[model samples]
Target: MKFTERLWQDIAPIYNSILKHGFVNELMAGSLPTFLFQYYIQQDALYLADFSRALNLLAARSIRTDDVLQFTQFAQNAILVERALHETYFSIYAIEPATQKMPACFAYTNYLLATTSLQSIAVGAAAVLPCFWIYRQVGKHIYQQALQENPYRTWIDTYAGEAFDVSVNQMLAITDRLAEQAGAAERQQMQDAFRISSQLEWYFWNDAYTQNQWQV
Candidate 1:
């Protein structure tokens, strides 16, 4: 069987189920503290720098194409936007950025760089899909839930921000395009990467929740 077929086969169920669950409102809100704790407060800039360099290495050859160029632009923009959050967190906590050690965030970002560095674009798409799709779904769900609960207004407001939605949609559209153009084997590789990354995302969150046990 082709990689795409296998990849779709593996994730179709989980993807469908996630869409079905309609994103957990409470869970999404609850997750904000952990996200802040991990990415903004604890994560070191070196981690992002390393991950960004890894991506640059992977795209060195392939980034000549217009599509690839656009993707890289998106990535650069994303890093900028997310980094702003880190700055905000630093201001709020008066925490020196030097002491932060966001292992889980680094691990997740590293996984992306490592996979994309060695794998094809299809594989890179798979590695990245989870982050895009999960965030969109989570954001949408949280926004809907916020209509009633009114809890975590800041969290709801952040995810519901137009910029975040735009980025997620743009990334997903890119992934869809890549998947459509990919050959069977490439698709499978992409799918495999996606499944692993998806599960890894959940685990990363779990890791954030259980801070202090972080090793990598």
Candidate 2:
């Protein structure tokens, strides 16, 4: 089996939990409270901003020119394409610009940034892969189940769309290629990074659903 396939297997339980999470189920039913959706989109915007930075860090560290170009384009899409979707939601919901990252967003993004900046390129790629892979999975799953008149239709379509699929495929290919060349120790680190990031994906959605805030 390919490394990406193993990564998926490792996180199968978490992905199942995500699919069954109340936020996702309510989203598909189009009955999610607007306030929860609003919180998600706002936190997501903050995430993409930092996500783009992590991609750029990988681009700078990438040894292969093609890998560099791919990471750069990925960063651009995080800023341009995904953020455009967030902006549309902001306008529709009249969500104010988020002033700070919520705890989950802060932790997740910092993990990506630290992994990409300080770790081997292979491990960094693993850290960021869950976001792309899991979002695509959830998006497609929701698209298949989403109500016809769902308020979050645009959000679902964006992640499930052909364009997003192309980028995700590229990332998966990059990760597999990196994994093939990595030493055993590095591959273990990659798996650990991938697992942690996958868990964080679950927390991010749950945090939005709970309207998580800094208690201090």
Clash pairs for candidate 2: none
lDDT, candidate 2, 23-125, per-residue tens: 9999989999999999999899999999999999999998799999999999999999987898899999999989799999999999999999999999999
After superposing candidate 2 on the true structure, give the runs of residues whose Cα lies further than 4 Å from its correct spot: none
C-alpha RMSD by candidate, in order: 4.7, 0.6
Clash statistics: count for each candidate: 5, 0
Q: Candidate 2, 59: how far from true, in Å?
A: 0.3
lDDT of 1 by residue, 161-207 (tens): 78777866666666776778889787767777889877665555455
Badly placed stretches (over 4 Å) of model 1 are: 1-41, 44-59, 98-103, 147-155, 212-216
Instruction: Provide the lDDT at 69 for model 1.
Output: 73
- Model 2 score (lDDT): 0.96
lDDT of 2 at 67: 95
